[model samples]
Target: EIYYNDTEAKKYAGNSRIIEIQTAMSERAIELLNLPNHPCYILDIGCGSGLSGEVLSDQGHTWVGVDISASMLGVAVSREVEGDLFNHDMGQGLFFRAGTFDAAISISAVQWLCNQDQAHHNVQRRLRKFFQSLYKCLVRGGKAVIQFYPENGQQMEMISSAAMISGFSGGFVVDYPNSTKAKKYFLCLCAGSAEMNYTVPAAKGLDEK
Candidate 1:
């Protein structure tokens, strides 16, 4: 909220590099989701300026976007994005009915849960709450693909552990592992036991020159 003020939000929305990177990441996340080509209700966590939600909408999916920054949502509205928007903090937890979403995706979000913004902020507890709510709101076998930038290995481990503890089953997918600039981390999580056999897919361009 504070960091993404009105000016920052507008700049973020207007930046070509940011839009390109965000679009590519969102597309990759959706690919990892592996859902059929049909309309579904989706949740976009930390959907800043609806960049990722726009991708979801492009796939003909109905999506609800939630972000802590009102400024960002304002930008999204000004852009005439199609998804429903909400001004809420994900760390507190998603306040939706059980099995309300068919799938969930986040682009460059979720890692904010690690920041100890206030005196009462507990990183682990907040992560647990967020994942638990996400788990409950998704139908059994539903998946969530969250793309984030972890500051360190420990932060990545903490996030994965919390998701697993909250009953999500899946792991990380690193694209372009060999390229520092192009590398991206996506935590692909399933709400419950999936009918299909699941394995951690290998990283893309892992052996690229």
Candidate 2:
């Protein structure tokens, strides 16, 4: 379903305004990840067109990316992005070895998993499996910042509840609560101790039209 438009894929293959928006949204998630100064490996979940991976590469961090769309991954490969790219349905769970990534980030992707496209496609089960794999893939202190748009309160609860059941330090950060265009919702999860707390930076100037 994500591979709905060839023109959109082609546009991403080159360079365009959509990528700019993706990059910007992903940057916010990366900031929430809060990696150390030294280099670390990252997992870019739903890393469409490699735009978010570009940001990670620019930060001097190595990364691996996974997406459900072959067309999108094709575009990413054409860009010669500095990361390994592969195909995977996140609902089925990631295939990474335990503690393989320092951190993980997903931009505007998780919400898609909520769609019940198939009779066997259970949303809650899928969400839990996704988070379970994510928790295993991350290092002891690794955190995942997923930026998503919830259609309603039910989705938000279901998603958050799944994360908690999977054992993520349960909390979500809201960016630009006042803004329309720039508002973002990040579900923050930590694989390590529950005592590890962070102060999500304020939305700041993201609200400006």
Candidate 3:
């Protein structure tokens, strides 16, 4: 496993080619967000090295970033995007107050939550917290665009159910076809509204005895 705190992860911060791809995708995603002309509060959940921040800033949105890895956030802060940065784990409830943001985005991060079959159960739990927290933090009619890798339909269905149970409406699911260099990517978008109660499955224990 690549240590997220390692220097190698930080090196990706300065990779122009990678940055270009991220920027392009972010721009397209933001367009789908359909933000108002006035400045809006935007959160980049699991933001790595501020690549999203760059694109959000360029688009004139007020952006903030949160990441679990300090080393990765260090590289993000070094970019000096005009927004706040926090060291945070998305699995935990968001610390912000209700209706704190207009929109939220998470890209290429949710798959990290899936480790094993039991771990996949944990992914559902974490995603429930994530969707609930995002719902609480977004104003009515606000949007959330999340891009994640789904191994198959089962995993994708789990995520979709979590979104609805977490109080989001008008869910949109899109599948990106596999490219020459990479596998397919899945994008899920949902509009936040009232809160709904959800019970996530618990992870199976390792001990057989």
Best by lDDT: 1
Report backbone clashes per prediction: 0, 0, 0
Task: State in Å the error of residue 67, model 3.
Answer: 0.7
Best by TM-score: 1
Q: Give per-residue CA lDDT, model 2, range 1-209, as digits (tens).
A: 56535677787656667777788888888888878889999999998889999999999999999999888888888889999998899999999999999999999889888865754337778888999999999998788999899898888988988887887884778777777876668887788866776444455455465
What is residue 44's positional error in candidate 2, in angstroms?
0.4
Model 3: pairs clashing at backbone N, Cα or C within 3 Å:
none
| Residue 108 in model 1: lDDT | 86
lDDT of 3 by residue, 131-165 (tens): 78888888777777776667777777777788788
> Alpha-carbon error at 181 in model 1, in Å?
0.7
Predicted structure 3, TM vs. truth: 0.81
Each candidate: RMSD: 1.7, 2.3, 9.2
Number of the candidate with higher lDDT, 1 or 2: 1
Q: Which stretches of candidate 2 lie over 4 Å from their true place?
A: 12-15, 119-121, 197-202, 205-209
Ranking by TM-score: 1, 2, 3
The Cα local distance difference test for each model comes to: 0.89, 0.84, 0.70
- Give the worst 10-residue stretch by lDDT in candidate 1: 193-202
